[model samples]
Target: MMIVTTDQVAGYEIVEVKGYVKGSTIQTKHIGRDITAGLKGIVGGEIKGYNEMMTEARKLAMHRMVQEAEEKGANAIIGMRMQTSTVMSAAAEIITYGTAVVLEKIN
Candidate 1:
């Protein structure tokens, strides 16, 4: 499937709107990683553990969104966007959303 941040995909024409599709997941900080993060925070450096966690979470959310689009018979997703929010003290929610659409080559 093709996904783009813009409303239109180059070389393709949108034929049908399958509606909006979204996927979200919540992730919490690991205790061990939190401790390491705290120490790193004191020195002010990149928190690799948390970074990796967020990256994976984003990928999962995007995958789910794509699955939904496919289920709707959409070949592409436009206006794709991602959002991150603090769900709780230790947890964060990642959301991926877009407009599912059928696209045809602009032959």
Candidate 2:
């Protein structure tokens, strides 16, 4: 499915609005990674473990959002956005949302 952050897709015209679609997932920090991250923070470097976790979370959230759009008979999603929020002490929630729509390619 086509997903864009803008309201409009360059080569496709929106013909039907299927309304809003959203998906979310929660992830928590691993104690082992936390320890690694703490040491890395002191040295000031990228936290690969946390980065990988967030990347996976985004993929899952986006996949769920796409599934919802498909269920709604939407071939595309516009104005797609992702949000990350700290839900608890060591947990974070990732949310993906957008307007589901059917698009026709312009000839």
Winning candidate number (TM-score): 1
Task: Give the per-residue lDDT digits (tens) of candidate 2, residues 8-74.
Answer: 9888899999999999999999998899999998999999999999999999999999999999999
Off by over 4 Å in 1: none
TM-score of each: 0.97, 0.97
Worst 10-residue lDDT window for candidate 1 reads 6-15
lDDT for each of the candidates?
A: 0.96, 0.97
Best candidate, lDDT: 2
Off by over 4 Å in 2: none
For model 1, how big is the CA root-mean-square deviation?
A: 0.7
**Clash totals in order:** 0, 0
Error of 2 at 85 (Å): 0.6
Q: In model 1, how large is the Cα lDDT of residue 42? A: 96
